[model samples]
Target: MEATKSADVVVVCAGLVEMAEVEGVDRDTLSLTPGHDELIKRVAAAHKKVAVVLSNGAPVSMPWLADVSAVLEGYLGGQAGAGGLADLLTGKVTPSGKLAETFPLSLEDTSAKPYPGGPLVVEYRESLYVGYRYYDTAKIDVLFPFGYGLSYTKFEYRDLSLKQTGDKVTVSFKVKNSGAVAGKEIAQVYVRDVESTWFRPEKELKGFAKVDLQPGEEKEVSVELGTRAFAYYDTGSKDWVVEAGEFEILVGASSQDIRLKASHKLAGQGIVSAADKAKLASYYNVTPTTEFTLSAFEALLGRPVPANIQPGKGQFTMNTPLSDMTDSFMGRQMNKVMQNEIAKMIKGREDTPTGLTMRTMAKEMPLRSIAMGGGSLNLSKLKAILLMINGHTFQGIKALLGKK
Candidate 1:
């Protein structure tokens, strides 16, 4: 409050912590550290010239984005990060890097719906439609799209052309540094099947090239697209297929920022074996926005998802999650007793976030994790627990007694 009135510019820093972004654990929200958003809101409210610097590894929801002047995504930039940031902020070096992934408006907007699908099981429901593919196809608004970047200079795109001769394809365009500065611009080329028999992304990145330009300098750039660039794998034929269609070539700075485009009609046909067609037809038509159902996924797996099936006695195996180990009376009792033991271990901190997380993990953990974590489970004890869940309670108790 005291500094805002006197300060010329306010620089607020925000990002995710190690706990929020780790290998095994999944973040509940894309929001930057809980209070960082509010802190930025306050700072932006205090001053009009507010800039934000982000240091997180992944996408973070930024509700206060419009309120701030500038945002620098300084993502986990190693040891010399501070010095490089200084160069960028002071204009000693023009920032020319582009975003590798899309930043969604919220965690819910991401393609991976119901994220952290499981501790023991994970399903790639989105399949091929991930990142920009999902956002562009679904027409969902994003915070920042993939390949998005802003530099010291502005660039213009013109004279885009596309040529296709059977298996060979070429895309050419011109990019000019319209702004009064020298900078490098990355030209991205994406291919779209204007019409297709199977569900596919609106456009796929085929090729890209970086060009250095001076003020008013325009350079022609060409990117070649091979057969693989415009093809999708057909399980029926067990090969890549380029179905007869009109393919659109799009050139842009980012996935959303299309500057130029041209279309070329391709004459190609694919053969689908009847057997594979029967097996794959049901699962092959899932569009970018469509929900990947259990039935569809099962069709792909050629069987029912084991996780979806209710675990019964003789079914609660080592791979089964602890949450599913409650079918029989004996199984329920054993699960209850083990849960009580976990509760006692985390009793004092039960109300805390860490404790809650631990509890959730314990519930989600597979029986194998107990053996690995030394959580009072050895091979013999595990065998006994399996026996208890699998309806041999008397035998399981006998094994427990004889276990060294």
Candidate 2:
């Protein structure tokens, strides 16, 4: 502490728990390990020139961020990590990497908690609200957010414009390096459905452009969006579909740091089938037993259901058989049409049902095993296991594992 107080700069090297992603091991908290946090705090108190260098693969809560003079996220940078960091510190190289995830203010502020629950099953309760999506939508505060990064220089965004041509929307903007040092700036473009039939996140990243600029230099950045950019994955149709509505275009350096905005209207492809549309209506309203009625469904679908059909007394649930809803000739024909459409959607997606089943099993079995106390099966551990199973010598395996 005394040396830190006297030193010109105190560079604190810290990281997350080493057991991250290992079997039967998960971080107990988002904060830095107990001793590390205290050490950084104490050093920051004693020294005005305190810089923290983090070697974590994931975001960590930084309570003392305001107290530190600077922060460098090294991110488990292999053998050459130290040299690269040294270059960054000495002003030999400018840092350009951006955060791929958000850092919550508190662990509780995250979307899902009690993670890795149960020995045999871990439910993904937070469907689409994963990282920045949750924080941005819920208006939750965070220490840092996705796409956040700092360079030795500064950049300014201006001249925002949007244009639509047949199914494609193009966003164009200008980025200028306003600082003395030359560096790169990543301009991110996000889209939000102004009004949607199905629930949607506030805004989603659709495109980005990275531009390197010299001091006082400016460049025009343009990002194009296709159908998928404005579309949502509709499980009912087993296809991506864009609904007719207004969509807001957001440009930002980070998710929370939105700088420019524009709006566009989509005419919509109107490609969803009537049966699938009915299925969506039923799934969203009837099955959940909400106050939503057939009329509302009709309004959404832009058509009415068959006149002969009648929902039975009481609210319908998924358990209610299709036959119970109606027995008329039209109803039976609609069912057959739906069945054929579903078959068509499923066909050609996979060559064989066996291949599809095996692929799904291969993807899910590992998660199940990991939840059931079978060791973690991540890429790193898988590589290690492969080295061992291939009968390679220990030294050879170690050499292969060495930093690139």
Candidate 3:
């Protein structure tokens, strides 16, 4: 706060370093670091010209968004990213990037909650309600919607039309730069089954096109959609089914920001034998099931879901991550040693993003992965550790000797 009070511009670089990031695991939360969030809020409060440049691999929440002047989501920029950011910030080029994933207001607003809950099993009970599919369908307010991006210029959508040639669709629209500067716009195309009274997403992103325009420049953009765009996979029959119905075509800047819409009746031979409407809970409903029930989910899974459980004493395996193994005595000892090792790896720069991530990975990483990731911890040593963790220390010692 003291540093930014006298500064003209405060640029806060924050967000996930590189997602739950690769083979490590899912992130526990969609939040910025406590220190980063505090700095952003305080800095933005002091200086209105706060430009937050987020360099992350996954979507993160921005609670202090309204307090800041500008935000640039620079997700996982590579070697030339610094030069690119300079060009964008210095007005050498116009920003034309769109968010591929929705940024929830908080972790609770997301479809996938209780994330990374257990070591053994995770239930994706939200079914098809994934990403924008869930947010758009549930009408949940988000910090940023999918396919959302802002430019130095404004854009207008006009002459929206859809041409249906048999089962395929070609959606056409005209985009004009309504603002003074030249800019690029992403026109996202979404398809909704207006006649579908089933467990379908309210709308699904089918296709999209990038439109570049000069001031007052207008260009026609078209997106092609095949049968797959209008069909859903039938689990029972193990095939895609496109039932004859009325479909709505939507073109917009994001899933929630629909600019132009048109409806078309798709002519089909009706539902095939593959579509078992009885099991779908669709034949009796007039709208997509918004509130998903456990029974319904279990019915969809074709089996009962096992109760979510956590790893504990006598259950520790080489596959258990250092983080999950805290329930056991030997596991806690192992975690302490690993933390000391990681502390040495980062040394003085323990607070940096790379350092924080390295430390985080060490905790989340499975005991067996040390061998798999080509470290000194081999399979024999891993077996010994597992045996000791499960309360067979003498046996573990014998096993280690046998391996040697």
Candidate 4:
């Protein structure tokens, strides 16, 4: 401490240790392990100009952030990382990298708690509510949010617009460099379903564009949104379906730093199957057997079910297994209809089983089962099955297939 007080400037290189970052080793805490935090605090108190260079892969709680002059994140950089840091520090390279994950104020503020459940089995209780999605939706305060990065220059956002044609949404906004130096800004677009029937995250990242702007230079940025942007995975239908309702378009530099907003109404696609409609009701926190009626199902499906179909006696929950439902008169009819429709959908597929049975396959089938030798598969049907089994969106499957 005494030696640092004599220096003109203090540079503290602090971050997680090797044990905390390894794959199999689980970190016990989100703190800067042991005396690192205290050391940084002492250095900041001793020197007026103190810059902290973090050298960890994951986010750590920084209690001394406000006391430091600057903080640079160097996330496990490789051989040339030291040289890159020197260049950034000396103003030879403008830092434009952003945080891909959120940094919580403390360990308790994070979504993942009681982490690393067991050596053999690790249960992911957080599910989709990970990182910024959890913090943003739960309204939890964090030290830094996803896509947050500070540059030497400043940028301004203005004139946000949302244009929709059929199922596509186009988001456009103007960005200007308001500071003295040239730098790049990553503009992010997040969408929120205002009145969805199913539960959805408060906001989801739909699109993002990065642009380099010279000082006083202005540019118009546009990001396109497809069906997946405003849709949810409907487990019953085995498809991604968009609910008809209002959607909020948010444009911002970071998840917590939303600057502009607009709303759009989507004309939802009608449901085709009775199972999907029931699942949608379940998503709305309603028991399908009690809250759902035959009339309502017909309305959503855009066609009437067989007149003979009737829910005769006891209460039925959406969680009721398909086999159990088949004992009822209405259930039996609905089951046959669903089976016929499914058969028609996969009529010509090579992988279509000779005898379709309720029995589970003896072994896991490879993804290539849908494809024939040197021939194309039914991509639409394959996408539906993929979404059903793997819970992946069409865009996600496309990414796995290396398609643009």
Give me the runs in candidate 3 sitting further than 4 Å from their true place: 1-10, 16-26, 114-116, 269-291, 306-317, 322-340, 343-363, 373-375, 384-399
**lDDT, candidate 3, 220-260, per-residue tens:** 99999999998877665677877788989999998888999
Worst window of 10 by summed lDDT in candidate 3? 282-291
**lDDT of each prediction vs. the true structure?**
0.80, 0.70, 0.80, 0.70
lDDT of 2: 0.70
> Which tens-of-lDDT digit does each residue in 122-148 have in candidate 1?
677566778998888888899999999
Better of 2 and 3 by lDDT: 3
TM, every model: 0.80, 0.67, 0.82, 0.66
TM for candidate 4 is 0.66
Clashing residue pairs in candidate 2 (N, C-alpha, C atoms within 3 angstroms): none
- Mark the regions of model 2 whose C-alpha exceeds 4 Å error after superposition: 20-24, 114-119, 269-404
In model 1, which regions exceed 4 Å deviation?
78-80, 107-127, 163-166, 214-218, 271-307, 326-353, 374-385, 388-404
Candidate 2 lDDT over 1-404, as tens digits, reads 87775688899999864544233334556877557889899999988899999988777888889999999999889988999999998889888778889988888777665353332334443445678877777777788898999999999999999988887888999999999999999999999988777656678999999999999999999999999998887655667888998999999999988999988888775345565556445333221122334455445444554444334423222233333324333334434543454456557644443334433333223212322334444445444333343333374257446643
> Which of 1 and 4 is ahead in lDDT?
1
Q: How well is each residue in 254-361 modelled by candidate 4, as lDDT tens digits?
A: 998898999999888634355554544522332212233445444444455444332222433332323344445544543454456456655765242222221111
Query: Lowest summed-lDDT stretch of 10 residues in model 1?
Result: 279-288
Model 2 misses residue 358 by how many Å? 31
Alpha carbon lDDT at 375, candidate 2: 42
Q: After superposition, how far is residue 298 of candidate 2 from its true place, in Å?
A: 23
